[model samples]
Every structure is written in C-alpha cells, then in structure tokens.
Target: MKPISWCSAVIKVERRAHAVHTLRFPAHLPTSSESRLPSVTSDNEIVQNIIAQAFSAIINLKHLFLLGQNSQPASIKLSTLASCTFSLCSFAGQVSGDLGIQEQLDFLLKHPTIEYWVPTEPFLRSVNSFPTNILPNLRQTVLVRPSLMKALGGRPIESLMILFIDITHSRAVEYTHGSLGPDWSTIDIISNLSRAAPNLKILTLGSLIKDDSVITAENQQSLVDAVARFCHLKILVLNTYMCALQKHTDEDPDPENPLEHSVAWEGRSPAQARQVATQFMTACPSLRRLSFPDTGPSPTNSLTYILSGTKAKLDGFYIIDNSGWWLR
Candidate 1:
C-alpha cells in the first residue's frame, strides 16, 4: 500500500487500533530454556509481522509501544504514528547498532502527525549518531543521554516542550565515551551540551561524579558561563558534586603549613562557597526557582547580596536545604 493510501485508511478506522498492534510479553519465560530457543526468534518474528501487516492495512497508528526484554531487536519502521512509546522495559546491558533507531527518528521527524516519543535504551543510545533533521516534528521527547541533545541542535526541534535525560553512571559514561570518543573531560561534556540545546525549557542531568576535585575554578567558570547563555531555561536538574575539601600532600609549598582546603582555595575559606552561591543567585535575573542541595553553604554576605538586580522577576530560591519550603 502507498503511504498516502495507508494514511487515509488509518484515519477512517483509527479509534479501534489502540489494541490492534500492541505487543505484550508474558510475565514468566523459562530461565533454563536451552531447548526452546527458537521460540524467542519466533516471538520477535511474530511481533514484526503484526506491525508490518497492521501498518499496511490501517495506514494510521494512533499509539505504538515497542518494548524489548530479551535483548532482541525491537524494530518498527512506521514513519507516522499519532503517538508512540518504546520501552526496553528490562534491558540488562548495552544495546548497539544505528539502522533501527535512525529509521524511527527519521519517521518521527518527517511526520508532524506524531505527538510524543519515549524510546528505550540502546535505541536511544544511537541519538548522537543521527542526523540533525530527525525529530523536527517532535514536541515531547524523553531521552537518556546528552548526545540526544545533538539531535536538537540548530533549533530544529524548538517545538520541544519537555526533555528528560537519564544520565545514570553507565548512561553518562556512554554519552561521554560516544560523543567525546577518547578526548573526554567533564568540561567538554558541559560545554557541548550547553551549546547544543540552548532553547531547552526543562533539562535534567544525572551523573556519578567520582571526584569533586575535578571542578576547578576554570571548569566552574565554564559551567556558570553555560548557564548564563541559556536564557529560556526554566528548570535545571543536575546530580553532580557539591564541593571538595582539599587534603594535604607531602611536597607542600609552605612546609610550615601544608595545603589544606582553605590554603588550596587561595585563602578563600570554605565559607566562601556561600559567597559563590550568592553570586550565582545574583547572575540570573530571570531565574524563577533556584535550588542547589548541599552543593555548598548558603550565600555569605547576605546583606551585600542583591536580589533587587534580579529584574524583580525572581520568585523564590531552592537552596540545598529546606529554604524554599520553610519560606512557604
């Protein structure tokens, strides 16, 4: 069937399709399945056949959910589903390859008919490698890596209303390794993402930051600069280091007093962390809600801290503690 003709039929009988093409796996599959391996392949084949045949006949899919639990390929080439969600509900490890994921994004971008997308891991992992034109029609996307932000580069998907990134330890490592290749650094990760998804309204990042010491003055400036650039950001969630207390070493510049946290900070006491926070609060005038948990101390020199310069558009602050709640 031609794509157009199939579309019309889909429009004619769209209401009945919520259950037609759905695939659900049974709760229990034998763990000791040495003899029934063919069943796994047969199951995937059945799913693919159902989707292919259904698309050809109905021409329009209202909702589609493709989930994989057996590490098998969950392939769907339908270019224009009204709503779709793919959950690799239980993928034990990494999944790879570009062809299957690329096709889905291509279809999702080309057709304005699609309204939502929730792709699973391994498939979602390939977003960095996809071309810029994919997801042009996407309005809401739930992604698992920063590389997915590359797909949003150049404002192609400015229509995006929501974006969720699941940057767990393994996921963060995959993004860093995949996009940065070998020349990877925490600063590189922050800089590239800031530029790639400038218009993002809501953003979340989760990482297993191993060392707070990695956040030096230079990198900290990079982070602050990046935040300053994105004026439209309304919500930012990051799971990273708060601060690092320096430890003394053998070869001290001053033998009388080895480098302590205070010495390492160039005479700036740990209390200055609160001063830095105050500077941050002052920088973003349009900021509505600011929250940083235990990142450092509350801003010191509160009297000198100017919220008046905030353009009066500020609502409240979400300090690492219960400041926001207590004020309410």
Candidate 2:
C-alpha cells in the first residue's frame, strides 16, 4: 500500500479517530528504529492536503507535531487545521530543521491554547521570527536555544530543559554569528532564564563533555554563588560527565585501609559533583533534589543526586549503571 492510499484508509476511520489524542506529520519517512518521535512526512501538496484532511477529521487532538527535515525546506500546510483543534494542548512546530518555518507562524499566532512548543534549535530562535504573542500560554519547553528568552521574557513558564548534545566535539569556531552549531560557553543560561521565566521550578541542563565533571576545592565557592540566580528552582539536573559503567578499581585497595570508599567509578569521582550540588542547595534553598544523570541511552539504571538524609552519599553516586536521565 502506498502512502497516499494508506492515508485514505486511515480517514475512513474518522468516526473512530475522534478518540485519537495525538497527531504528527513527518516530512521524511523513518524506518522502524526511528521510533523516538513519529511524525508526518512527504511535502507533496496532495500528501500535505491528505494529512490536513486526516487531521481535520480527527476531533480530539491534544498534541500535534509538524517536523521538518534538513534535506529540504519545510512545507507543511496548516491553514485548514484551525477548526480541527478545540482540545489541542501542545503543538511542536518545525522541529529539527533550520529553514522554512515562516509559513507556520500563522497557525501559532492564532492559537493561545498551545501551552508547549519545541522549535528547531539555534536557528529558529536566533532569527526571532516567533513574535511574542505567538506563545502566550507557553508554560514548559525543551529549549536547545535560549536566545528565545528575549521574546519569551515574561511568561508564566514553569519548567525548561536546555539539552545540548555534541557527538563530534572537534569543530573550530568562527564568528559568522549563525546557528550552524550552538556555543553554550558564551551564553549565560541562568541569566537568560532569570529574565525570561522567573517562576520556573524544574530546570535540566544536559551537555556532553570530554573532561571530568569535578570542580576543585578552591573554586567551589564561586560556583555556588553563580547558581543562586533563580528563586523557585526546585530540581536542578546537570549531566555532562561520562564515566565507566563499573565500580571495580585497577590497583590494590590502598593496602592499609581495605574498606575505604576512595575507589573511582570508571576514572571520575562524584565527590565534586555532590559538593557542588550541596553548594547549589546552600545558595538556593528552594532546591530539594539535585541530580547528576548518566550520559545515556542505556538499558540499566541511570543516576541521581537528590538531597538524602541517610549515610548513602556514595550509594548511587559512583555506581555507573548507564540508564535513565534526571527526571526528564
């Protein structure tokens, strides 16, 4: 069965599709393993119309996604869906591509019930195309680009996750001043959030790093003061350090003290990470749980560093179980 004909078969179920709560449009078809995010594809005008017709027939959509691919410019039609979404709560517009989102701004502008938006990173936010009124009710977001905070300055946003993934960390920098790749070094995320979403509670900042995530004893004080920017930040998760997935030491166990817990997981220690977490709690007393999640996509357990009362500081600290992210 071809895609267009397949869509026709799906539309026949319009009577039953009223219960369908989510819809997605993927422009590039994905195979079985691309199940991370399923969406509508194909830019053919007929396909676009068919998808819109399918969406229009469904009456109970809560989440709608329109994804764009880097291979071509984005060309998803949205004008017809205005009457389709009486219950639409979340909408992801033009995720993953940089260009061709100018056409979708109309749909976002007219809809105030869309509480969440996940735009393509770096470029979309850098261009400032999303007028401030486009996302009036936006409360939570997965932000790969924080420059958008300027336009989103004073919303009632409650949560934000600044997730940065750098697989090949060997690129040179030139000040072409574009979003080809995001440089978090120069951007002060906390300052941006303090200005944009002052009421934010849960914030997750995940980055991929090559070095150990340990800070020295001398500079720990300064790091603590820097994190006191937000008032209601309860859960703060910083995941950048990667370590071995085992707790076995290489050399002899210090011969003198056999039961000492000085051994390292892989080659890095979570002592500094914990100390810094403590400092964050000290500076910002509202923080109840601080997590250092694993560098993952793992099948086992991940990591956490919440404020615990027991003597299990190193219980889940140094044990690298390659699993879940910090409360994401």
Candidate 3:
C-alpha cells in the first residue's frame, strides 16, 4: 500500500464503507490459537508505528474516523493520533481490553478542536457510567447504544444538536423472559438532556429486537415527557414495540364470554402507543419530521391527529416496518 499524502483521508480495514474522510487503522491482534501468535508482540508494535507515521503524514486533516474490531490500540498509539488537530473524531466497531470506554473518551477530550465525537457499533462493554466533564466544542453525538445515555447525564451540552440513541443491539437480550429490560435510570439520563443539550435538533430512538420485551408504558410516557423538553427538536425517530398484555390460556373456556377468561398481556395496546407519539409531537412545536416503527396492522390514529392539528409544516412522516406484508 502506498503512503497516503492527502489532506482528507478515509482508511478502512474492513470491507464495509463507514465514514468518508475517515482514518482507520488495523488493530487486529493475533490469538494463541493462530500460527502468527508467536510474533504478535512484534506485529502490534509495527502496526502502532505505522499508525503513528500515518497520523503524522496527514498535515491538514480536519475530520478523522477510526475503525477497528475486537481490540483497540494502547493509550500511546491513541495519543499519537490525538496530537493531530481535527474537528471531528469517530471510533467504530467493538473495542475491548486495553482501550476501554473511559480511555476512548479521554482520547477524544485531548483533542481541543473536536466538535463531534461519534462511537459506532459495540464500543463499550456496558454503558453504566460516563465522564462528568463536558466536551466544550462537542456539537453532535451518536450514542448507538442505550447504555451510552449515561454520558449525557448531569453535564450541560448546550451546543449538542444531533443525538441518536440506538438500543437495538443491547435491547435484544432484554426481550427474553425473566429479563427486566434496560436500566430505567437511563430514562432520567435522557430527561436531563432537555437542560443539558437544550439545542438538540434531532433525536432518534430505535430498537432492533424482534421479540415483545418493549419499554413499559410508564417509561414510554416518561421518555415522551423528557423529549418534549427539547423545544428545538425538529426530527424524531421512535422505533419501538408497544407492550402487549399476554392472555392466559387453558384447556377449556366459556364460548359465551371469552372476555371472562382473557388475561392482560405484558405489552400495551395500539392506543397507548399513539398517545406517546402524540405527546412528543405536541411537546416539540418545532418538530417537522416524525418516524415510527411499522409493526404490522398497528393503529396510526395518533399520527393522523398530529398531521391534522399541528401547523409545523412537516417535512416527512415515515414508518419503517421491514416486514414484507406492509409492502403488499
């Protein structure tokens, strides 16, 4: 591979295309089971040195995107890149061992010009706690995991404009029986965003879990109230399953009164779902775009109400129901 001499660079080790004008370095470490394990120590040092050289080569870089899998470079390797002046820095893919979440945040903080800090994929093992100090120049953020919500708590991010909370990967396990779902405290963290990120223009909350372990009605209402606080929000994407109460079934039941034998499901009805959506639209008067999940024959009366009553001149209203039946 020839040395890169461009002012803007996008280096991807993986096949997938992520960010443009991004600088990605390979951080793969050989395991003991692999034949190259004997030379792993030397190989890592070489990779680090190459990364350092590459960082030095980019003289006038403005935006940087780092992509790696399974492992991340040590603090020293990261420090090399931090030395450069960049306005945006993004770390994508699974990061474990040496460079944990705190260290990654530290690296971002070191760069004084960084206005956007995006960490994609399963970066943190868990999003329980976060640094207290605010990133002075940070204006945009993408918290792809629900756990990352902890990062926004308490601190005032007055400049933050775009925020994305994608809990699809983390919410999968919560759907199983006996699982209580994600920490309810995360909701408080989000609610605080109204004051913290008062200027937030866009907010997206998506869940990829196919099962029925949906957010409780109480929490959903709380989320609506919290989001309503973002007075400047223009776009909102809410992809979640409404809680449905499971019915009790037995060998025999009265045909005359089936309602007598029915039991409450664990999830909420379509009406409750509409109520939550309506609250968000009503709260954020500046809202122009609204997106909801396409969950089969779910009622959309709430959306209709928003369109009829609100005078925000909506840019678009979308339903992302991937199920082929919706298309038919």
Model 2 lDDT at residue 255: 35
Candidate topping lDDT = 2
The digit string of per-residue lDDT tens for model 2 on 68-98 reads 4445444444554645655566866444243
Name the better of 1 and 2 by lDDT: 2
Residue by residue across 1-328, what tens digits does model 1's lDDT show? 5322343555457565433443232212222243333675774454444444445444333444433333343234343222344321111122223346656555555554443455545566555555545544444455545566675666433322212223222222323334544344445655676688666555444333344424555466666666666666655544444442132233323222222232334543333443444445455434433333323322211111223344212222333321111010
Instruction: Provide the overall lDDT of each model, using Cα atoms, as 2-decimal numbers.
Output: 0.41, 0.53, 0.45
Write the number of the candidate with greater TM-score, choosing between 1 and 2: 2
- Candidate 3 residue lDDT tens string, 167-272: 2232223222111234433345457556656677766544534333354655666666777778788766655544421222232332443322334212324343
| Candidate 3 clash pair list | 168-208, 243-267, 243-268, 244-267, 244-268, 245-265, 245-266, 245-267, 246-265, 246-266
Clashes found in each candidate (C-alpha, N, C closer than 3 A): 2, 7, 10
